[model samples]
Target: MDGDNPRTPLLSIVQESYLPKTVSIALKCILVGLNIASIAIGVIFMNECPGQYLIPYYLIISGVACLLFLCMTCLPCVDEEQVTSVTLANLCAQGVLLLFLFAFFIAGNVWIYSLYHGPWNDPSSPEYCARVLYLYAFWIITLCHLCFLVLLCTYLCLLLGLYILKRSIFGSRSS
Candidate 1:
Protein backbone atom coordinates (compact mmCIF):
# COMPACT_ATOMS: atom_id res chain seq x y z
CA MET A 1 0.00 0.00 0.00
CA ASP A 2 1.16 3.53 -0.68
CA GLY A 3 2.18 5.74 2.25
CA ASP A 4 -0.17 8.42 1.00
CA ASN A 5 -3.12 6.24 1.92
CA PRO A 6 -2.95 6.42 5.71
CA ARG A 7 -6.17 4.50 6.16
CA THR A 8 -5.41 1.77 3.66
CA PRO A 9 -3.89 -0.98 5.77
CA LEU A 10 -4.82 0.29 9.19
CA LEU A 11 -8.49 1.17 8.74
CA SER A 12 -9.48 -0.14 5.35
CA ILE A 13 -12.79 -1.41 6.69
CA VAL A 14 -13.66 1.86 8.38
CA GLN A 15 -12.68 3.86 5.30
CA GLU A 16 -14.79 1.60 3.11
CA SER A 17 -17.73 2.13 5.46
CA TYR A 18 -17.07 5.90 5.52
CA LEU A 19 -17.44 5.94 9.29
CA PRO A 20 -14.56 8.35 9.85
CA LYS A 21 -15.91 10.80 7.33
CA THR A 22 -19.37 10.62 8.81
CA VAL A 23 -18.15 11.15 12.36
CA SER A 24 -15.91 14.00 11.29
CA ILE A 25 -18.74 15.72 9.49
CA ALA A 26 -21.14 15.25 12.37
CA LEU A 27 -18.70 16.56 14.93
CA LYS A 28 -17.84 19.56 12.81
CA CYS A 29 -21.50 20.38 12.37
CA ILE A 30 -22.17 20.06 16.08
CA LEU A 31 -19.21 22.30 16.91
CA VAL A 32 -20.31 24.92 14.41
CA GLY A 33 -23.85 24.86 15.71
CA LEU A 34 -22.75 25.14 19.32
CA ASN A 35 -20.48 28.04 18.48
CA ILE A 36 -23.28 29.86 16.75
CA ALA A 37 -25.65 29.23 19.60
CA SER A 38 -23.15 30.46 22.14
CA ILE A 39 -22.55 33.60 20.11
CA ALA A 40 -26.25 34.30 19.94
CA ILE A 41 -26.70 33.78 23.64
CA GLY A 42 -23.79 36.08 24.38
CA VAL A 43 -25.13 38.78 22.09
CA ILE A 44 -28.59 38.63 23.62
CA PHE A 45 -27.09 39.16 27.06
CA MET A 46 -24.40 41.59 26.04
CA ASN A 47 -22.99 43.59 28.95
CA GLU A 48 -20.24 46.18 29.34
CA CYS A 49 -18.28 44.17 31.86
CA PRO A 50 -14.55 43.72 31.45
CA GLY A 51 -13.49 40.64 29.46
CA GLN A 52 -17.05 40.24 28.16
CA TYR A 53 -15.74 40.28 24.56
CA LEU A 54 -14.04 36.91 25.01
CA ILE A 55 -17.24 34.92 24.58
CA PRO A 56 -18.06 36.14 21.08
CA TYR A 57 -14.38 36.19 20.09
CA TYR A 58 -13.92 32.53 20.96
CA LEU A 59 -17.20 31.54 19.37
CA ILE A 60 -16.25 33.23 16.12
CA ILE A 61 -12.86 31.53 16.00
CA SER A 62 -14.31 28.11 16.70
CA GLY A 63 -17.11 28.66 14.22
CA VAL A 64 -14.64 29.54 11.48
CA ALA A 65 -12.49 26.53 12.31
CA CYS A 66 -15.49 24.24 12.14
CA LEU A 67 -16.48 25.71 8.77
CA LEU A 68 -12.97 25.18 7.45
CA PHE A 69 -13.05 21.60 8.69
CA LEU A 70 -16.34 21.01 6.92
CA CYS A 71 -15.02 22.47 3.72
CA MET A 72 -11.86 20.35 3.84
CA THR A 73 -13.83 17.16 4.44
CA CYS A 74 -16.31 17.97 1.66
CA LEU A 75 -13.64 18.35 -0.98
CA PRO A 76 -13.90 15.30 -3.20
CA CYS A 77 -10.33 15.20 -4.45
CA VAL A 78 -8.52 15.23 -1.11
CA ASP A 79 -5.76 12.63 -1.12
CA GLU A 80 -4.96 10.54 1.94
CA GLU A 81 -1.72 12.44 2.49
CA GLN A 82 -3.58 15.71 2.35
CA VAL A 83 -6.26 14.37 4.64
CA THR A 84 -3.77 13.13 7.19
CA SER A 85 -1.75 16.33 7.18
CA VAL A 86 -4.73 18.61 7.27
CA THR A 87 -6.46 16.67 10.00
CA LEU A 88 -3.35 16.62 12.14
CA ALA A 89 -2.83 20.33 11.72
CA ASN A 90 -6.45 21.10 12.40
CA LEU A 91 -6.53 18.95 15.51
CA CYS A 92 -3.38 20.53 16.87
CA ALA A 93 -4.65 24.03 16.30
CA GLN A 94 -8.03 23.19 17.79
CA GLY A 95 -6.44 21.54 20.80
CA VAL A 96 -4.52 24.70 21.56
CA LEU A 97 -7.57 26.84 21.00
CA LEU A 98 -9.67 24.65 23.23
CA LEU A 99 -7.07 24.81 25.97
CA PHE A 100 -7.18 28.57 25.86
CA LEU A 101 -10.96 28.52 25.82
CA PHE A 102 -11.09 26.21 28.81
CA ALA A 103 -8.90 28.54 30.81
CA PHE A 104 -10.83 31.57 29.73
CA PHE A 105 -14.13 30.01 30.59
CA ILE A 106 -12.90 28.94 33.98
CA ALA A 107 -11.62 32.42 34.68
CA GLY A 108 -14.87 33.96 33.52
CA ASN A 109 -16.89 31.57 35.60
CA VAL A 110 -14.92 32.44 38.69
CA TRP A 111 -15.30 36.13 38.04
CA ILE A 112 -19.02 35.79 37.53
CA TYR A 113 -19.35 33.61 40.57
CA SER A 114 -17.54 36.23 42.62
CA LEU A 115 -20.10 38.77 41.51
CA TYR A 116 -22.78 36.67 43.13
CA HIS A 117 -21.16 37.15 46.52
CA GLY A 118 -20.51 40.84 45.97
CA PRO A 119 -22.93 43.75 45.56
CA TRP A 120 -25.04 41.75 43.10
CA ASN A 121 -26.13 39.36 45.85
CA ASP A 122 -29.73 40.54 45.62
CA PRO A 123 -31.74 38.08 43.54
CA SER A 124 -34.03 40.85 42.27
CA SER A 125 -31.15 42.97 41.02
CA PRO A 126 -30.39 43.27 37.31
CA GLU A 127 -26.70 42.79 38.00
CA TYR A 128 -27.46 39.54 39.78
CA CYS A 129 -29.58 38.29 36.88
CA ALA A 130 -26.93 39.23 34.36
CA ARG A 131 -24.28 37.38 36.33
CA VAL A 132 -26.49 34.34 36.46
CA LEU A 133 -26.95 34.45 32.70
CA TYR A 134 -23.24 34.86 32.13
CA LEU A 135 -22.57 31.94 34.43
CA TYR A 136 -25.01 29.79 32.50
CA ALA A 137 -23.49 30.69 29.18
CA PHE A 138 -19.99 30.02 30.43
CA TRP A 139 -21.04 26.63 31.75
CA ILE A 140 -22.61 25.66 28.43
CA ILE A 141 -19.62 26.90 26.49
CA THR A 142 -17.28 24.96 28.78
CA LEU A 143 -19.25 21.79 28.24
CA CYS A 144 -19.20 22.25 24.47
CA HIS A 145 -15.46 22.82 24.52
CA LEU A 146 -15.01 19.71 26.64
CA CYS A 147 -17.02 17.66 24.17
CA PHE A 148 -14.92 18.92 21.29
CA LEU A 149 -11.76 18.12 23.22
CA VAL A 150 -12.93 14.56 23.76
CA LEU A 151 -13.74 14.16 20.09
CA LEU A 152 -10.38 15.61 19.07
CA CYS A 153 -8.55 13.32 21.51
CA THR A 154 -10.35 10.27 20.23
CA TYR A 155 -9.59 11.14 16.61
CA LEU A 156 -5.97 11.78 17.46
CA CYS A 157 -5.67 8.43 19.18
CA LEU A 158 -7.06 6.64 16.14
CA LEU A 159 -4.71 8.50 13.81
CA LEU A 160 -1.75 7.80 16.05
CA GLY A 161 -2.58 4.11 16.14
CA LEU A 162 -2.70 4.01 12.37
CA TYR A 163 0.60 5.86 12.14
CA ILE A 164 2.26 3.46 14.56
CA LEU A 165 0.91 0.48 12.67
CA LYS A 166 2.18 1.91 9.39
CA ARG A 167 5.61 2.54 10.87
CA SER A 168 5.83 -0.98 12.22
CA ILE A 169 4.76 -2.52 8.95
CA PHE A 170 7.03 -0.37 6.83
CA GLY A 171 10.06 -0.88 9.11
CA SER A 172 11.80 2.54 9.19
CA ARG A 173 10.73 3.64 5.74
CA SER A 174 9.76 7.31 5.77
CA SER A 175 6.33 8.20 4.47
Candidate 2:
Protein backbone atom coordinates (compact mmCIF):
# COMPACT_ATOMS: atom_id res chain seq x y z
CA MET A 1 0.00 0.00 0.00
CA ASP A 2 2.95 2.35 0.76
CA GLY A 3 4.99 4.04 -2.03
CA ASP A 4 8.21 3.30 -0.07
CA ASN A 5 7.58 -0.45 -0.61
CA PRO A 6 8.65 -0.66 -4.28
CA ARG A 7 8.05 -4.42 -4.55
CA THR A 8 4.37 -4.82 -5.35
CA PRO A 9 2.12 -7.76 -6.29
CA LEU A 10 1.17 -5.85 -9.45
CA LEU A 11 4.73 -6.21 -10.79
CA SER A 12 4.51 -9.99 -10.60
CA ILE A 13 1.08 -9.92 -12.19
CA VAL A 14 2.31 -7.79 -15.05
CA GLN A 15 5.34 -9.95 -15.72
CA GLU A 16 3.35 -13.13 -15.57
CA SER A 17 0.75 -11.67 -17.88
CA TYR A 18 3.18 -10.14 -20.36
CA LEU A 19 5.64 -13.02 -20.54
CA PRO A 20 4.74 -15.56 -23.27
CA LYS A 21 4.33 -19.18 -22.39
CA THR A 22 7.84 -19.66 -21.04
CA VAL A 23 6.42 -22.45 -18.97
CA SER A 24 5.25 -25.85 -20.25
CA ILE A 25 8.49 -26.40 -22.13
CA ALA A 26 8.17 -30.15 -22.79
CA LEU A 27 4.51 -30.04 -23.79
CA LYS A 28 5.15 -26.97 -25.92
CA CYS A 29 7.93 -28.82 -27.72
CA ILE A 30 5.66 -31.76 -28.44
CA LEU A 31 2.97 -29.48 -29.76
CA VAL A 32 5.52 -27.70 -31.89
CA GLY A 33 6.84 -30.98 -33.32
CA LEU A 34 3.33 -32.03 -34.29
CA ASN A 35 2.66 -28.62 -35.85
CA ILE A 36 5.80 -28.81 -37.98
CA ALA A 37 4.84 -32.19 -39.34
CA SER A 38 1.32 -31.04 -40.12
CA ILE A 39 2.47 -27.85 -41.82
CA ALA A 40 4.99 -29.85 -43.87
CA ILE A 41 2.25 -32.06 -45.25
CA GLY A 42 -0.03 -29.10 -46.04
CA VAL A 43 2.67 -27.15 -47.88
CA ILE A 44 3.86 -30.23 -49.76
CA PHE A 45 0.44 -31.02 -51.16
CA MET A 46 -0.55 -27.39 -51.66
CA ASN A 47 2.52 -26.65 -53.74
CA GLU A 48 2.62 -29.95 -55.61
CA CYS A 49 -0.98 -30.23 -56.77
CA PRO A 50 -2.89 -27.04 -56.43
CA GLY A 51 -5.60 -28.34 -58.74
CA GLN A 52 -6.00 -31.99 -57.84
CA TYR A 53 -8.62 -33.49 -55.56
CA LEU A 54 -8.40 -30.91 -52.76
CA ILE A 55 -10.23 -32.87 -50.12
CA PRO A 56 -7.07 -34.10 -48.46
CA TYR A 57 -5.48 -30.68 -48.72
CA TYR A 58 -8.45 -29.02 -47.09
CA LEU A 59 -8.60 -31.53 -44.26
CA ILE A 60 -4.89 -31.40 -43.55
CA ILE A 61 -4.48 -27.64 -43.77
CA SER A 62 -7.56 -26.95 -41.69
CA GLY A 63 -6.52 -29.58 -39.19
CA VAL A 64 -3.16 -27.89 -38.74
CA ALA A 65 -4.66 -24.45 -38.44
CA CYS A 66 -7.21 -25.63 -35.92
CA LEU A 67 -4.57 -27.38 -33.90
CA LEU A 68 -2.33 -24.32 -33.82
CA PHE A 69 -5.22 -22.06 -33.02
CA LEU A 70 -6.25 -24.33 -30.19
CA CYS A 71 -2.78 -24.49 -28.72
CA MET A 72 -2.23 -20.74 -28.79
CA THR A 73 -5.65 -20.02 -27.45
CA CYS A 74 -5.07 -22.39 -24.55
CA LEU A 75 -1.85 -20.76 -23.45
CA PRO A 76 -1.99 -18.44 -20.43
CA CYS A 77 -2.59 -14.85 -21.52
CA VAL A 78 -0.50 -12.96 -19.02
CA ASP A 79 2.02 -11.45 -21.44
CA GLU A 80 -0.08 -9.07 -23.49
CA GLU A 81 2.72 -8.12 -25.85
CA GLN A 82 3.74 -11.69 -26.59
CA VAL A 83 0.13 -12.73 -26.89
CA THR A 84 -0.55 -9.95 -29.40
CA SER A 85 2.43 -10.94 -31.50
CA VAL A 86 1.43 -14.58 -31.54
CA THR A 87 -2.19 -13.73 -32.36
CA LEU A 88 -1.23 -11.55 -35.30
CA ALA A 89 1.07 -14.27 -36.61
CA ASN A 90 -1.65 -16.88 -36.21
CA LEU A 91 -4.27 -14.77 -38.00
CA CYS A 92 -2.05 -14.14 -41.00
CA ALA A 93 -1.09 -17.77 -41.38
CA GLN A 94 -4.56 -19.11 -40.70
CA GLY A 95 -6.20 -16.56 -42.99
CA VAL A 96 -4.07 -17.66 -45.93
CA LEU A 97 -4.71 -21.33 -45.33
CA LEU A 98 -8.44 -20.91 -44.84
CA LEU A 99 -8.85 -18.50 -47.76
CA PHE A 100 -7.00 -20.93 -50.00
CA LEU A 101 -9.42 -23.60 -48.94
CA PHE A 102 -12.41 -21.36 -49.49
CA ALA A 103 -11.23 -20.30 -52.92
CA PHE A 104 -10.52 -23.88 -53.95
CA PHE A 105 -13.99 -25.20 -53.18
CA ILE A 106 -15.79 -22.20 -54.63
CA ALA A 107 -13.77 -22.24 -57.84
CA GLY A 108 -14.17 -25.97 -58.20
CA ASN A 109 -17.91 -25.64 -58.04
CA VAL A 110 -17.91 -22.88 -60.65
CA TRP A 111 -15.59 -24.83 -62.94
CA ILE A 112 -17.71 -27.95 -62.82
CA TYR A 113 -20.82 -25.92 -63.46
CA SER A 114 -19.33 -24.12 -66.44
CA LEU A 115 -17.84 -27.23 -68.00
CA TYR A 116 -21.26 -28.83 -68.06
CA HIS A 117 -23.07 -25.94 -69.80
CA GLY A 118 -20.37 -23.86 -71.56
CA PRO A 119 -21.88 -20.53 -72.67
CA TRP A 120 -25.29 -22.13 -72.78
CA ASN A 121 -26.69 -25.00 -70.78
CA ASP A 122 -28.72 -27.50 -72.79
CA PRO A 123 -30.12 -30.76 -71.58
CA SER A 124 -29.54 -32.33 -75.05
CA SER A 125 -25.96 -31.13 -75.76
CA PRO A 126 -22.71 -31.96 -73.93
CA GLU A 127 -22.02 -28.98 -71.69
CA TYR A 128 -18.76 -27.57 -73.08
CA CYS A 129 -19.47 -24.18 -71.56
CA ALA A 130 -18.68 -25.76 -68.20
CA ARG A 131 -14.97 -25.80 -68.99
CA VAL A 132 -14.94 -22.11 -69.80
CA LEU A 133 -16.66 -21.31 -66.55
CA TYR A 134 -14.24 -23.55 -64.71
CA LEU A 135 -11.31 -21.56 -66.09
CA TYR A 136 -12.87 -18.34 -64.93
CA ALA A 137 -13.50 -19.66 -61.42
CA PHE A 138 -10.05 -21.23 -61.13
CA TRP A 139 -8.19 -18.07 -62.16
CA ILE A 140 -10.30 -15.96 -59.85
CA ILE A 141 -9.56 -18.31 -56.97
CA THR A 142 -5.86 -18.23 -57.84
CA LEU A 143 -5.79 -14.46 -57.78
CA CYS A 144 -7.55 -14.34 -54.40
CA HIS A 145 -5.03 -16.75 -52.91
CA LEU A 146 -2.17 -14.55 -54.14
CA CYS A 147 -3.66 -11.49 -52.50
CA PHE A 148 -4.28 -13.38 -49.23
CA LEU A 149 -0.64 -14.37 -49.06
CA VAL A 150 0.49 -10.81 -49.63
CA LEU A 151 -1.64 -9.52 -46.80
CA LEU A 152 -0.45 -12.30 -44.52
CA CYS A 153 3.17 -11.35 -45.23
CA THR A 154 2.49 -7.78 -44.25
CA TYR A 155 0.95 -8.75 -40.89
CA LEU A 156 3.75 -11.22 -40.20
CA CYS A 157 6.29 -8.48 -40.79
CA LEU A 158 4.47 -6.23 -38.37
CA LEU A 159 4.60 -8.93 -35.72
CA LEU A 160 8.33 -9.35 -36.28
CA GLY A 161 8.77 -5.59 -35.95
CA LEU A 162 6.93 -5.73 -32.62
CA TYR A 163 9.24 -8.49 -31.47
CA ILE A 164 12.22 -6.28 -32.28
CA LEU A 165 10.67 -3.43 -30.37
CA LYS A 166 10.15 -5.59 -27.32
CA ARG A 167 13.76 -6.76 -27.51
CA SER A 168 15.19 -3.23 -27.74
CA ILE A 169 13.11 -2.01 -24.83
CA PHE A 170 14.30 -4.82 -22.62
CA GLY A 171 17.93 -4.50 -23.73
CA SER A 172 18.20 -0.78 -23.06
CA ARG A 173 16.37 -1.00 -19.73
CA SER A 174 18.61 -3.83 -18.53
CA SER A 175 21.87 -2.10 -19.53
Candidate 3:
Protein backbone atom coordinates (compact mmCIF):
# COMPACT_ATOMS: atom_id res chain seq x y z
CA MET A 1 0.00 0.00 0.00
CA ASP A 2 2.73 2.50 1.00
CA GLY A 3 4.72 1.35 -2.02
CA ASP A 4 1.98 2.61 -4.34
CA ASN A 5 2.86 6.29 -3.66
CA PRO A 6 6.40 6.14 -2.42
CA ARG A 7 8.07 9.48 -1.92
CA THR A 8 10.64 10.29 -4.56
CA PRO A 9 12.22 13.70 -3.99
CA LEU A 10 14.24 13.62 -7.18
CA LEU A 11 11.20 12.71 -9.23
CA SER A 12 9.27 15.62 -7.79
CA ILE A 13 12.18 17.94 -8.50
CA VAL A 14 12.30 16.92 -12.14
CA GLN A 15 8.53 17.16 -12.45
CA GLU A 16 8.47 20.74 -11.19
CA SER A 17 10.46 22.26 -14.01
CA TYR A 18 11.38 25.97 -13.76
CA LEU A 19 9.11 27.69 -16.27
CA PRO A 20 6.09 26.73 -18.29
CA LYS A 21 6.21 27.75 -21.97
CA THR A 22 2.84 29.48 -21.86
CA VAL A 23 3.91 31.51 -18.84
CA SER A 24 7.15 32.53 -20.55
CA ILE A 25 5.42 33.67 -23.74
CA ALA A 26 2.77 35.50 -21.76
CA LEU A 27 5.41 37.24 -19.68
CA LYS A 28 7.24 38.32 -22.81
CA CYS A 29 4.01 39.75 -24.16
CA ILE A 30 3.43 41.56 -20.90
CA LEU A 31 6.90 43.04 -21.13
CA VAL A 32 6.22 44.34 -24.64
CA GLY A 33 2.94 45.83 -23.51
CA LEU A 34 4.61 47.49 -20.54
CA ASN A 35 7.37 49.02 -22.64
CA ILE A 36 4.85 50.40 -25.10
CA ALA A 37 2.71 51.82 -22.28
CA SER A 38 5.69 53.52 -20.74
CA ILE A 39 6.64 55.05 -24.03
CA ALA A 40 3.09 56.22 -24.60
CA ILE A 41 2.64 57.59 -21.09
CA GLY A 42 5.91 59.44 -21.30
CA VAL A 43 4.58 61.05 -24.44
CA ILE A 44 1.10 61.84 -23.04
CA PHE A 45 2.07 62.97 -19.55
CA MET A 46 5.17 64.81 -20.57
CA ASN A 47 4.42 67.65 -18.15
CA GLU A 48 3.43 65.79 -14.99
CA CYS A 49 5.69 62.77 -15.06
CA PRO A 50 7.95 63.90 -17.88
CA GLY A 51 9.85 60.69 -18.40
CA GLN A 52 9.20 59.18 -15.00
CA TYR A 53 5.98 57.16 -14.86
CA LEU A 54 5.74 56.56 -18.56
CA ILE A 55 6.01 52.79 -18.37
CA PRO A 56 6.87 51.62 -14.85
CA TYR A 57 10.53 51.03 -15.53
CA TYR A 58 10.89 48.38 -12.86
CA LEU A 59 8.80 46.14 -15.07
CA ILE A 60 11.73 45.98 -17.47
CA ILE A 61 13.95 44.64 -14.73
CA SER A 62 11.28 42.29 -13.54
CA GLY A 63 10.76 41.15 -17.10
CA VAL A 64 14.45 40.41 -17.46
CA ALA A 65 14.57 38.48 -14.20
CA CYS A 66 11.53 36.50 -15.20
CA LEU A 67 13.11 35.71 -18.54
CA LEU A 68 16.38 34.62 -17.01
CA PHE A 69 14.62 32.50 -14.42
CA LEU A 70 12.58 30.97 -17.20
CA CYS A 71 15.74 30.22 -19.11
CA MET A 72 17.60 28.72 -16.17
CA THR A 73 14.74 26.65 -14.85
CA CYS A 74 13.00 25.78 -18.11
CA LEU A 75 16.20 24.41 -19.57
CA PRO A 76 18.75 22.63 -17.48
CA CYS A 77 22.31 23.94 -17.36
CA VAL A 78 24.21 22.44 -20.27
CA ASP A 79 27.56 21.94 -18.61
CA GLU A 80 27.24 21.58 -14.87
CA GLU A 81 24.22 19.25 -14.49
CA GLN A 82 24.19 21.05 -11.15
CA VAL A 83 22.07 24.09 -10.33
CA THR A 84 24.79 26.54 -9.20
CA SER A 85 26.13 27.63 -12.57
CA VAL A 86 23.50 30.33 -13.13
CA THR A 87 25.66 33.44 -13.20
CA LEU A 88 25.32 36.57 -11.08
CA ALA A 89 26.10 38.58 -14.18
CA ASN A 90 22.60 37.82 -15.48
CA LEU A 91 20.89 38.54 -12.15
CA CYS A 92 22.83 41.75 -11.59
CA ALA A 93 21.91 43.10 -15.00
CA GLN A 94 18.27 42.52 -14.22
CA GLY A 95 18.60 43.95 -10.69
CA VAL A 96 20.28 47.11 -11.86
CA LEU A 97 17.35 47.69 -14.21
CA LEU A 98 14.91 47.28 -11.28
CA LEU A 99 16.87 49.56 -8.94
CA PHE A 100 17.01 52.30 -11.52
CA LEU A 101 13.27 52.03 -12.12
CA PHE A 102 12.40 52.34 -8.41
CA ALA A 103 14.85 55.09 -7.63
CA PHE A 104 14.39 57.37 -10.62
CA PHE A 105 10.82 56.80 -11.70
CA ILE A 106 9.14 55.94 -8.39
CA ALA A 107 11.04 57.45 -5.45
CA GLY A 108 12.85 60.39 -7.01
CA ASN A 109 9.91 61.59 -9.04
CA VAL A 110 7.57 61.31 -6.07
CA TRP A 111 9.97 63.37 -4.04
CA ILE A 112 9.82 66.00 -6.72
CA TYR A 113 6.04 65.97 -6.68
CA SER A 114 5.95 66.33 -2.91
CA LEU A 115 8.36 69.24 -2.87
CA TYR A 116 7.26 70.90 -6.06
CA HIS A 117 5.44 74.20 -5.71
CA GLY A 118 5.72 75.99 -9.04
CA PRO A 119 8.07 76.71 -11.90
CA TRP A 120 9.63 79.79 -10.24
CA ASN A 121 11.24 79.91 -6.77
CA ASP A 122 14.02 81.63 -4.88
CA PRO A 123 16.86 79.16 -5.38
CA SER A 124 18.17 79.34 -1.80
CA SER A 125 18.00 77.48 1.56
CA PRO A 126 19.08 73.87 2.26
CA GLU A 127 15.62 72.47 1.58
CA TYR A 128 15.58 74.26 -1.72
CA CYS A 129 19.07 72.97 -2.31
CA ALA A 130 17.85 69.47 -1.57
CA ARG A 131 15.07 69.93 -4.09
CA VAL A 132 17.61 71.30 -6.50
CA LEU A 133 19.77 68.33 -5.80
CA TYR A 134 16.86 66.07 -6.61
CA LEU A 135 16.30 68.20 -9.67
CA TYR A 136 19.90 67.63 -10.56
CA ALA A 137 19.27 64.02 -9.83
CA PHE A 138 16.72 64.12 -12.63
CA TRP A 139 19.61 63.96 -15.09
CA ILE A 140 21.17 61.20 -13.06
CA ILE A 141 17.75 59.65 -12.83
CA THR A 142 17.31 59.98 -16.56
CA LEU A 143 20.72 58.48 -17.01
CA CYS A 144 19.64 55.65 -14.77
CA HIS A 145 16.48 55.23 -16.83
CA LEU A 146 18.63 55.13 -19.90
CA CYS A 147 20.83 52.68 -18.08
CA PHE A 148 17.80 50.44 -17.63
CA LEU A 149 17.06 50.89 -21.30
CA VAL A 150 20.55 49.70 -22.07
CA LEU A 151 20.11 47.04 -19.44
CA LEU A 152 17.11 45.88 -21.42
CA CYS A 153 19.30 45.68 -24.49
CA THR A 154 21.84 43.78 -22.46
CA TYR A 155 19.16 41.30 -21.41
CA LEU A 156 18.42 40.63 -25.07
CA CYS A 157 22.10 40.21 -25.72
CA LEU A 158 22.25 37.59 -22.99
CA LEU A 159 19.42 35.73 -24.63
CA LEU A 160 21.36 35.77 -27.87
CA GLY A 161 24.36 34.45 -25.99
CA LEU A 162 22.16 31.75 -24.50
CA TYR A 163 21.05 30.79 -27.99
CA ILE A 164 24.63 30.43 -29.14
CA LEU A 165 25.50 28.55 -25.99
CA LYS A 166 22.62 26.13 -26.40
CA ARG A 167 23.55 25.47 -29.99
CA SER A 168 27.18 24.77 -29.20
CA ILE A 169 26.52 22.65 -26.12
CA PHE A 170 23.56 20.51 -27.14
CA GLY A 171 23.54 21.00 -30.91
CA SER A 172 20.02 22.21 -30.38
CA ARG A 173 18.40 25.21 -32.03
CA SER A 174 16.31 27.50 -29.82
CA SER A 175 12.75 26.93 -30.77
Which candidate leads in TM-score?
Answer: 1
lDDT of each: 0.57, 0.51, 0.49
Per-residue alpha-carbon lDDT of candidate 1 for residues 16-96, written as tens digits (9 for 90 to 100): 435676787677677668667755655665553343445444444445555554454454436666643334455455567
Per-candidate clashes, comma-separated: 0, 13, 2
Q: Rank the candidates by TM-score, best first.
A: 1, 3, 2
State TM-scores per candidate.
0.45, 0.31, 0.32
Which is the winner by lDDT between candidate 2 and candidate 3?
2
What ranking of all candidate models by lDDT puts the best one first? 1, 2, 3
lDDT of 2 at 158: 95
C-alpha positional error of residue 41 in candidate 3 after TM-score superposition, expressed in Å: 2.1
lDDT of candidate 2 over 11-118, digit per residue (tens): 434333333455555556665665465455545544333233342354355446646655654544455466322344554665676676566556554543344334
Instruction: Report the poorest 10 consecutive residues by lDDT, candidate 2.
Output: 128-137
